[model samples]
Target: MALQHFAGRHDGNRPLVAADTVDDLLPDLVALRRDLHAHPELAFEEKRTAGIVAAALRLLGLEVHEGLAGTGVVGTLRHGDSARTVGLRADMDALPIAEQSRLGHASRYAGVHHGCGHDGHTAMLLGAARQLARTRRFDGTVHFIFQPAEEGRGGARVMVEQGLFERFPCDAVYALHNWPDLPLGHAQTRPGAIMAAADRFDIVLRGHGGHAAQPHRTPDVLLAASQLVVQLNTIVSRRIDPGESAVLSVTRVAGGSSHNVLPAEATLTGTVRSFDAGAQDLIEAALRDAAAGVALAHGVEADVTYHRYYPATVNSEAEAQLALEAAAAAGLQASVAPRPAFTSEDFAFLLRERPGAYLWLGQGGERALHHPCYDFNDDALPHGVRWFCAVAERALPMDASSPTARR
Candidate 1:
């Protein structure tokens, strides 16, 4: 499982591609992808995974750096003499789900599984790094950013905070996520607001506890909180514009455990999702108002706290069109989507720093991401690698005369 094997049986002159261009690099991509699949790692804890990535980049003659935000790896493949740079990003984290892939090559970590298909993303980018380094058909630099903790901990933001852009500034940056619901070899994307802003709220309504037989003697916090949940639902369904899309799902609620006794306080927790700031603000306001109304109705004190998490994964129009063109050259049925996706991502941080597009690749009947039974489709690996290579070649065409040595 050395990096040598990842390069495959090669003479450097050996074609990583095929004559048709569409069906190229499948074997090598599969090998590397399977290797990563068997050994998955969790967010911000990808030490061995980092080592493997760094070694592969080094062997490909790219300048590699390790230890960013704990376990992020950045690989620089200089193709020509130009200051213009384009960065490609992949998240390197696994979830706390058990692996159901019975392949002799499943996750080694007992509780950690790459149900998110990050393993395939990492391998596809690595394949691009090697193939592009060998071909060098691009100008400027390609920074392969392997980030961690993308599954809720904001690892992309962490890298940005650590001067990822300042240290190796890029003119444009891009990222792609595998879409299980789409067909294979197809790429789907939208120009803006491709994903929603995800935020969570916790409300604890305090009231006097009393025996069940004498409910009127105490402020009934449970009843008040129950009403509040219904009121919160009315925020989106009744108050918010029907044209706009927003979700207020109360994912968790807890209070009393006894059968006959009333609890002193009842809690309500839920998430808010929206594509824009206006809708986000409106939802927050609606939640606060509903909680206040409920507390007043029951004469109970309410303590509400909201935590704003990842911003909406918005795609820059110009850059998104560029990615669409890349998919076009790669022979994908790429198009701008009608509606923005509601899933949030930390890559929104990267887009905030530079011009770039986040895209989706069809997973071809693959299991949904985060499913315990899911595994990345190996066939789609080559398609992803080709798209990566095609993106670099189009963005930064090679400078044959430039220095082509490992720096």
Candidate 2:
């Protein structure tokens, strides 16, 4: 089947040789994606999803491994005797959202939905794996990493901490996420800081409790907590440099339940996003300082705990260029992102271990990610599969200038 013969809503110019097999595999790919979307699982509880992935890879005759980080799966395929290896990763977990859309493939399990497009991501990589396994066009090996928990649970970090790279070594790695805002068949990435680092803070303000009628007898913690929330917004605008990007949002706040008595303690929690170490440090410090300053002025004690979950996803220059080239070869419009996204990804952990790039594949929808009405656009399946295949072939070529090619 020719690449140009595959007719769909996203059909464009003829793609490269890597996409020749996609025409015959589109039905199976779409079916698999819909099935996965119907049965959504959250975080580390992807037992059924992981099992399906493992079974599919085994059917492809690739060496499969499971049970790393609870439900992570890795599939290895080798062709020629080249030691060069590349890793292609796809997240396999869903989000905690109720199905609001009436599509046939909408989530059957209430409050569990594939709203973030991981279903499509997994299917695209699987399509590429099947094609690459059948054709054996590349000289080196490819590792298909199906990670389980990408929705704030840090499943990629778990895989890395469990010796993922040491077990199956790779010279380079890559991942793609669906972007609903960009037009279909368009891809975008950059060489540095593709996503921001995510950090969360928990603050506690303690004061003496007293009857509401006699407010002057007790320090008011609720007042201090409210002031702290207002102060946190200043960390990004006033404290940090005007040129740098950062965000501090107060997501949750808790206080007393009694109407007659002032609360003795109040709790505040929120997240911090930054692209550089300087901004991250400044944000953390500012949070602690603001909490202490407010609590002290109110004659109360403040306790703050800051946790850094995922670091910034900074792509290497060489891998970013290679990915753009692969996108061009796959007949997709590609460009560099103007600024890093505030959303954070656990794949940053994998990039830290090995050089790689994470690009956004355009799916083109009005609904944003994590929205109840959002669904993975099926028309972009061929584009994602072909891009992954082309990137693998470009990274691990059959015969470059040397016997082994280093990505």
Candidate 3:
């Protein structure tokens, strides 16, 4: 079973029937996913989920490492002596949304649910690990990364900061998310930025408060905040290149407590999304300047806090091609994504350190992500597992001519 002897003998490109790949195991996976969905946990609070993941990986005979980034788990499987390794990641966090679905597996915990399909992601990866362990068809090592807190808490970023790759040291990494927008059983991704860089900015306008009838005696913080909001909307359109894509949305505004009196302070909070670093920088700068200018015009002070969170999720050209090939091998309809999504993913941080690709698995559901009625399509579980296994096999094939490192 030495890896060196297994060289030049990989069957990753051989297509496998998605249904047959996990025929007997499908029910177990669906049950596991449903169990996870029923007891969804929030970001960085996945102790129960991590335990399940660890126990499952241990049963599969993989080396399991726990407690990275709080509730993160990494399972390593090696077949041979090849230095080359590949990593497959899945987020294990739920959103703070109430369950609206009446499914039997609906969230048992109030005000918490797996509206993002992470429950499905976790079960699928576990299925892949089980199959990969049983089959042992590939050389090198495969790291099954169960990351927590991907929902704005930056768990992936924290994992990288804590040296995830330094310990596991993958040649390339890959991640996937179920997309309701695409048809079921389809895999879509593209080289370049697949998801936008997400940044949050908060602005507090402070001014003198007075009765509404004497508005002339006080600086209108509400007016200033409103003007800044309007200005932020124009940054992507007028400030940046027309060819580049960017978005700045004012999602929250808080001001006056009473109708007859002007508030002394107004707070504005929103998000910015962009694909390029230049665009991110441009938007951040624009936000600060716009806030300051409006505050000065209104004779008030603007305290601006622009915090850059996640980088754009960019895929290496070679790895993207490999993912597409792997998807095809898994018998899923694979295609290049026509456009990058505005939503941000913490997986962007992993791509920054290693060459990798992020893909969208089609669930073919009408409900959008984060929707109350959203549910992970159990039918897509086998497809995801097959795709992950194929990607690991292809990325770390027995041959020495694996894809070159991109990061």
Model 3 collision count: 2
- lDDT pick, better of 1 and 3: 3
Model 1 worst lDDT window (10 residues) = 398-407
Q: Flag clash pairs in model 2.
A: none
What is residue 382's positional error in candidate 3, in angstroms?
0.9
- Return the lDDT, model 1, position 144: 97
Compose the digit string of candidate 3's lDDT tens values, residues 1-407: 11122111224424233234476677778878999999999999999999999988776667899999989999998887877799999999999999899999899999999999999999899889877876776778899999999999999998988889989999999999999999998999999999999998889999989999998999999999888888888888899999999989899999999989999999999999899999889888888889989988999999999988988999999999999999999999999999999999999999999999999999997999999999999899989999998888887776656562222
Estimate, for each residue in 1-407, the C-alpha lDDT of model 1 and write its tens digit: 65675654433433444333323456666777777888888889888888888988877767888888889999997745766688999888889998987887788889889888999999889887877766666778899999999998999999999999988788888889998878888898888888888899999999979998898899999899889988988898987788989888998889998999999989999899888788888889889988898899899999999988898888887778778888887778887777877778889989888888888998977477888889888877777787887777766755434332111
State residue 329's C-alpha deviation in candidate 3, in Å: 0.4
Give residue 251's lDDT in candidate 3 (0 to 100): 96
Q: Against the true structure, what is every candidate's RMSD?
A: 4.0, 5.0, 5.4
Candidate 2 stretches with Cα past 4 Å from truth are: 1-19, 402-407
Best-to-worst lDDT order: 2, 3, 1
Give the Å shift of residue 37 in candidate 2.
0.5
Model 3: which ten-residue window has the lowest total lDDT?
1-10
Q: Which residue pairs collide in model 3, if any?
A: 3-80, 3-81
Query: Which lDDT values do the candidates have, in the order given?
Result: 0.83, 0.89, 0.88
Q: List candidate 1 stretches off by more than 4 Å.
A: 8-25, 398-407
Q: Tell me the tens digit of each residue's lDDT in model 2 across 190-228.
A: 999999999999999999788988889999999999999
